[model samples]
Target: MNFASAWNAQGPLARQRREAMLARVGQLRALEQRAAERSAEARAVFEKRGQLLPRERVGLLLDPGTPYLPLCTLAGYLQDAREPDASVPGGGVVAGIGFVRGVRCMVVASDSGIDAGAIQPMGLEKILRVQEIALQNRLPFLHLVESAGANLMRYRVEGFVQGGALFRNLARLSAAGIPVITVQHGSGTAGGAYMPGLSDVVIMVRGRSRAFLAGPPLLKAATGEVATEEELGGAEMHTAMSGLGEYLAEDDRHALGIAREVVGRLGRAPTPALPQGGRVTASLPPPPGEGWGGGAPQREDLLTLMPANLREPVDMREVMVRLVDDGILEFKPLYGAATLCAQGRIGGHAVGFVSNNGPIDVPGANKATHFIQWMCQLGHPIVYLQNTTGYMVGRESEQGGMIKHGSKMIQAVTNATVPQLTIQCGASFGAGNYGMCGRGYAPRFLFSWPSARTAVMGGEQAARTMQIVTEAAHGRKGQRPDPVQAKAQFDKIVQVFESQADAFYTSGLLLDDGVIDPRDTRAVLAFCLDTIAEGEAAQPRPMQFGVARM
Candidate 1:
């Protein structure tokens, strides 16, 4: 690794930026904790019915003292229509890949504590993504089902159409020989009732479980036949008559115990590797200190390296030094100087790096395309540090085949068969966000630094473009443009853009998984890389059709 550290911490600006970043991280974490506690409403409701809260159910379901990778914790962040301040995160489910009786499974518990755990649009996206993860990694799928289904009043046609895919995926998981275990903790009526219907192993909590095609009110309205929840599809009824539930538990605790035993009986996955890793050490080694001698810059140097202003230029090299281990093996540094492609080890995991210091021109795009493909060929994961104004625009770039070259970069990013992890370190605007594996393109994992800002274009640029368009529209209408009114509108638009582009706002909407402390980047990247590696090494069984409950 060639080492030349240029990051030297000095002024008050660094201190100010560091303080701001830390405070934002703290605020977001607090919001998440607050959302979890807000489930107290549901807790009270459940308590009246003699039941545990959603989180409590999740904790009881998983094995103790094991890692739980809670994902997309800020799912319906600011998207709620009621009020911004009243919005709850976590969509409506608490889920992650964790262990149960030494067996790895994807566990999901509906946060019925909030609005009866109604499925929000973002929550739907979260569950679908987790299902894909469990299937691809060959992990047994588990569901702690208890939801009010979708909110009919706020329902979108797209959600209704897409929601069917979840059940289909469940069927696919079972057909692929991956066990689908579901515990009906509470109400699962209407379309939601399919939870127990599609699972290979179903455990229903007596008196608590409620799964039916339609509840009493809906049944009365549709068929003029009034049927109680228990008579239709309760734990006892399903276990004894319908055979929908394989086991009937006396209560929440009994239900969780039965689920654990079920997982234990399945033993290890067909591939035989746990998602969080199986090897256990007696004790964890101390984190590497200053004297450990990796030659990498101190983690705190990140604050000094990052510029507070987006327009101010920064050499990504200075930032890279603080992230890569023992410096980096610079790749194609001279050919596409604007796009730095380097090889490095972070937390001892070998990875190829691609970062942008400016707009991607013809050469930079091609260089990135070549480097991405090379990393895939080498079987090493690629890490993208996104900070670009996007592809250079204008007549000259057009003549230089910028369109064709930029297409090559996008193509490589979309099709490369490797674990691509993206870190939005700074500005992520326009096509640069897409080429750098933004949330839409679906990197294996996408994280942002608290200092990051993402949008189609910078606020000033977007505002100016709109202003010019407004003037042109006025001229076409044969009226003089009102400069004062236009300026007021322009400023408001800019403020909206800047505010929404904040890392916290974007993360709250599930645009990124969650913001990370810049200091934790290397370690977080290592953990994610190791996970995909272990998954790729596993082998799974496949069947022609899904296994039935019988």
Candidate 2:
């Protein structure tokens, strides 16, 4: 069914909402700038050393005029700072998927500007998550290494145990046939030495690069042996003597150039065409004033399409129209009227969309389950537009087996063969999040809009529920409840939920990849889908293990 937008961008309500959304977007940009500024503080030092900053290296390595989707920009926000104002996000690393010599690759650069790039707990998780995406999508992994490794002063036993996964994933990527390339730009001591060791190709900076099982102090203390860094794991030693590195460069810029050349030589094949009439979806031209390439839908009306207030319902199809290249093919629209399952194209890539007009009912759950399976079987990526209060509740819903059906939907989301991406545009409470491939469920990439709010339930409803339980306890004890105390308790509960459910708060905690402007939804989806497609097209020779130092 073709979607016709009745959205009026010039309408009074829409104008108001656009202004509000634009302000929120400004706030998100400000946070990103703060992280950049924090990194910029090291510019003088980098210049003195005749080296490029991490961000600059990334820019040089990427193909000109291509898109780079930065991941987890708000990571370690508020989690590591003494005050919210002092928080520097980015989790001590700069990571994204971008074109390297016309080939899409996952690039991770250590943001050594801050605290010498010591791994924050969230930073570890961020690296692991991106590595997982690279492995699952079969994209090459490129890492720019230069770190002090973990901060033993602030380390926890659990972090130490979980940190093992980082090294294991590097080997896993190599064994799975995806290339793991490393540029030893500065320091990689202790366990960090394994980063370059496991890479299929390692490029090292001559004077500056270092990777060793133990640095001078640690080696002297533990083994009563002392050796200069150069003799132990410097670029010259690693490349010529130890055979750990394949290429040795003179400086950061030279190293990055070598990395780019290596990627160019990888001989990655062009992305394969989608099966089952993929070109048909992009047959229509984009609406007037909407200017994304490949006939993608209009994004100009996006701010107007979504109401500022989440409780006010808007047709999910209206939002979908702006994201896809052409009209959507609604699947069993009549069966689950509120839960929409449609086939569309983003950036000319075939995709399946599951969105919510309201809470998920039994019919909705069953419909989504079937749609997910259908998309997986066809090998199309799934994009979830999450905006649900939760599953329907009440005697009528419970008897209808809401739990069974909702579980089926979650199971499908959890085990779907193809890539699944999620965008939280509005309310995402309780299990609705899980069923829609929320952060916990490990969606390939999950993003949120400024209007998003996530919680177990609405603040008022949670407060009221608690109030009722408290009153019942008092009645059972044959005592009257104090009105003032009960009111104060209810207010406290509401305050906590309301504060924690804000989009900024959740994003600061790394709940989603990053909060995005609603207008950029289509562009983001297209980049992600293209990455997945490229991965599907690639074929690399799997080995029993990573290229060893020998």
Candidate 3:
């Protein structure tokens, strides 16, 4: 047969073949459009959650306009079975090289909508792959976690064999001194919590997030006790009681913002400023009021500024701001309201400030411990403002582990080698005094203000002691005096406790060096700093022991 005749005879099948090819091409194009739509929807969902998507988060965390090098564009293989979704990058765990605050960082962000962000067998492999990347590059690893848990069914099917490799990788990164920061944007339950907990810093948003060893249902089943998510693992729970996390945020955006700031602080090059001299001291405010002995300012102003009644309270933070440098950086500022610790430049040199609110005891001590630890790390000087009544006592105090935690503060101060300057503002008595880095604790210089009520106990205790003594004398003499006469006798004896027999008495005994004006505190600190600088430079080495975990 002729070639043309044969082609015509086969025309029906050829036409059908061409039509099939066209149909497949159209189908693929439609799929591409649908995928673009789905991605857009995913971005929109992230916006609704007040969070940036994983890719966008990576972009913002890195240096401006820096491009991210994705770790893997597809999930890894199994023994022989091909994963239907193997084409997806990282199998829903998006990991790659990025930057935070202009410093290089490696990131692994989970997309919850994808398999509920569960760590399937393949997912675990992906996580380990990224961890290896971080360690190899010597970059900080940032985890944006919103995971339900390991894929339980997949894990069972695989004989629970996928977790060890991932955890080993985490331990390796941790040992390398490459910091890891985890941001819990949503539910972090089951095995998921371990990923973040292993990190150096854990940042969490408020209502939209939770993190725990297990979810509520599992806990209820395992323990037969039902607890709300917040009770189990909320921001408040972690920040205040457990101290599992370093920072807490009101929302995802806030968490990310703090992450950026923290990365900057951690990654900056250490540049210690030069020590200052007498010229710097001269510029400081005058000492406390005239009554305290130093010629700077009056201690009486403190009494008037504070209410006479003990029940009335003053904001110690405002007092600290007025006394310290203008550019103070407060730590755990929201978690502990009663204590304030900050790092700032004093006389152009970095120093740590530890101050307390009279109404709050252990929190103040806790804050002080953290400050001292930070100072030790930086090899900087520390200044303590002692203004606590005493260590808090009561049912609440006991539950807070006040005694043990407060002891930690005292130990930290005693062990600190940095030049510690202590200013007794008011009411430094009992254990609280020693915990405040008292004179006995070997401060470089200990100065008390005239208004300082430094007794073995507070003024109220003095009044009580006087009342008891007078009552005993009256009973022994068999003489009942009028209320007026009794009042006079009690007042005279109580006055003994209030006068030089107090802090002034200690000063006379040389237990306390002397009192200084409150306003002159700045000058005094500057002078101390200059003196320390003249005698010796700081050791230039970290303390060997008793380092508090950050």
lDDT of 2 by residue, 1-550 (tens): 6667787778898888888787777777777778777887998998998888877788788765556677787777777645868887778888887777777789898988788888889899889888988998888999999999989999798888899899999999999989899999999998789899888899999899999999989989999997898998889999998898999999988998999999888888533432221111111111222222343236667776666678888788888888888779999989988999999988789999999999999999999999999999999989999989999999999999999999999999999998899999988998998988899988888999888899999898899999999999999999888999999999999999988888878876788987777877888888787777777767778888866666
Model 3 per-residue lDDT tens digits across residues 275-394: 222111111111211121233222122233332233345454444544444556777776566776777766556788777766446676787788788899898888877777777888
Clash counts for all predictions: 0, 0, 13
Provide the lowest-lDDT 10-residue window in model 1: 278-287
lDDT of each: 0.80, 0.84, 0.60
Off by over 4 Å in 1: 9-11, 269-305, 322-326, 471-480
Count of backbone collisions in candidate 2? 0
- Output the number of the lDDT-best candidate: 2
Winner on TM-score between 2 and 3 is 2
How much does each candidate deviate from the true structure in C-alpha RMSD?
Answer: 4.5, 5.1, 33.1
Question: What's the C-alpha lDDT at position 387 in model 2?
Answer: 89
For model 1 the local lDDT of residue 455 reads 93
Clashing residue pairs for model 2: none
Q: Please report the TM-score between candidate 1 and the true structure.
A: 0.89
Per TM-score, the best of the predicted structures is 2
Q: Candidate 1's C-alpha lDDT? A: 0.80
